[model samples]
Target chain A: MDIRKQFGANVRKHRQATGLSQEQFALQHDIDRTYVSGIERGKRNPTIVIVNKFAKALDVSIADLFDGCD
Target chain B: MDIRKQFGANVRKHRQATGLSQEQFALQHDIDRTYVSGIERGKRNPTIVIVNKFAKALDVSIADLFDGCD
Candidate 1:
């Protein structure tokens, strides 16, 4: 019910929809695989830097990433 | 020159333009002041959840936040 949980869930959905594994995503973004896992699990609070990397690597707009989370 | 630094600079610019301290902005968004500070300094990578909170707290579109960062 929390916003962060919703956001994380959305991220997981998108990542899976794109057919990219967490390791693949992290490698594309030059981040640790565990970091990507942590983010999907809501164990990490990524900064804007990480978000930008994700936006670029995932080929999604930041708006798209945050959409419907509200 | 990195996207993250640019994003952080934009964030700081917007925050200062609105005359908000990190604590005030974090309070408004129910985030930790230190977390907000970390974001401004490009030391943290906020998740989409945090970005949404920031977009709402700052009254700006997520697109606007990423607009010139690229």
Candidate 2:
């Protein structure tokens, strides 16, 4: 899969694992809901800062988000 | 260190391992030399696409770029 898609999938997986809907996740993380949606749909290309935010919110390493993406 | 700085250090490490100067590596990878320099200095916040490009150029996984970053 494309890295963006893979990242989106990973984000979705981790978010779901936390039992938070996209909106809830965004609210809790201080990220825009629409932006989160875009990211989850692979329609957005977030910078490393934003990626780090997601990793922090998800309690995962940056590497974990790209796991199995190769 | 910050993730961006760590990423820059990792990029520099990999690029040096390949025995290529920033200009030479940029020319070979079709990336802007100044952009590479910016990335290496952690002054640029690259999106995942650019990160993927670096990973591909370095023949490493996205995870590798982030190794020891956390």
Candidate 3:
């Protein structure tokens, strides 16, 4: 189901929904901005803990990231 | 939120719910039983893609892995 793309799109959606830039998202999460870019592009494979971090930084839930992917 | 523990516990729950042993679960997902053990113990970190794989193999949604872990 291209979960990477689905997850990435959901992450991007959450970021945008919160009105945060990639840089802001990265900063808030203490992750590198480039990594955030990679995640959004579905180029980076992040771990479950990392996904949880993204969810936290975006003020969303791990479940939320799988809105359509699931 | 101790996401690792939360996430790992959820994985164990899903695996148990499906009545699959560690080896069986590992075989279905093509992941190593030891690695699966690590993940289930919250000792290993998995990527989003791997998480998706687990969800698929468990016949559950990614969100289900995060039921009480918002």
Candidate 4:
């Protein structure tokens, strides 16, 4: 399986589940909307630093990010 | 506790556990020795890209990177 694509789908699913727009999620993580978009589109692979930031912003664990992506 | 420090210690511990020097680990991950050194010193926050590479090279899961650091 393509982890990046799976990860992107997971990101999109979680973002929608939280009722947050890409821009809102980005702001919550102190990142740019484009960055979030890039990740969701599998155009960029985030670093662990950014991943941790997402975990915190989403009030989820790192493992949660992989939910449904496996 | 500082996650950066904990991560650094974890990185160092795993490297030693595998009997790999920083340079060896770097080569395994296709990263530079200085980059690994910076991470081990908590001076650099690796992106998920590098983390995944390390996970693959170490023959471990991402969760393993957190072992003994929590």
**Candidate 1 residue lDDT tens string, B8-31:** 777787888789788887787788
Residues B1-70 of candidate 2: C-alpha lDDT, one tens digit per residue: 8889989989999999999999999999999999999999988889998999999999988888888876
Which pairs of residues collide in model 4? Answer: A47-B47, A47-B48, A48-B47, A48-B48
Looking at model 4 chain B, which ten-residue stretch has the lowest summed lDDT?
B61-70
Cα RMSD for candidate 1?
4.2
Give candidate 2 misplaced runs (Cα > 4 Å): none
CAPRI-style quality class for the chain A–B interface of candidate 1:
acceptable
Best by DockQ: 2
lDDT of 4 by residue, A1-70 (tens): 4556766777777788899999987887778999889888878777666767776777767766655433
TM-score versus the correct structure, for each prediction? 0.60, 0.96, 0.88, 0.78
- Candidate 1 off by > 4 Å: A1-3, A27-30, B8-54
* lDDT of model 2, residue B13: 92
Go through the candidates in order and give the clash count of each.
5, 0, 4, 4
Weakest 10 consecutive residues of candidate 1 chain B by summed lDDT: B44-53
DockQ for each numbered candidate: 0.42, 0.84, 0.78, 0.34
- RMSD after Cα superposition, model 2: 0.9
Give the Å error, residue B22, model 2. Answer: 0.7
Segments in model 4 whose C-alpha atoms lie over 4 Å from true places: A1-3, A27-30, A66-70, B27-30, B66-70
Model 1 residue A14 lDDT score: 80
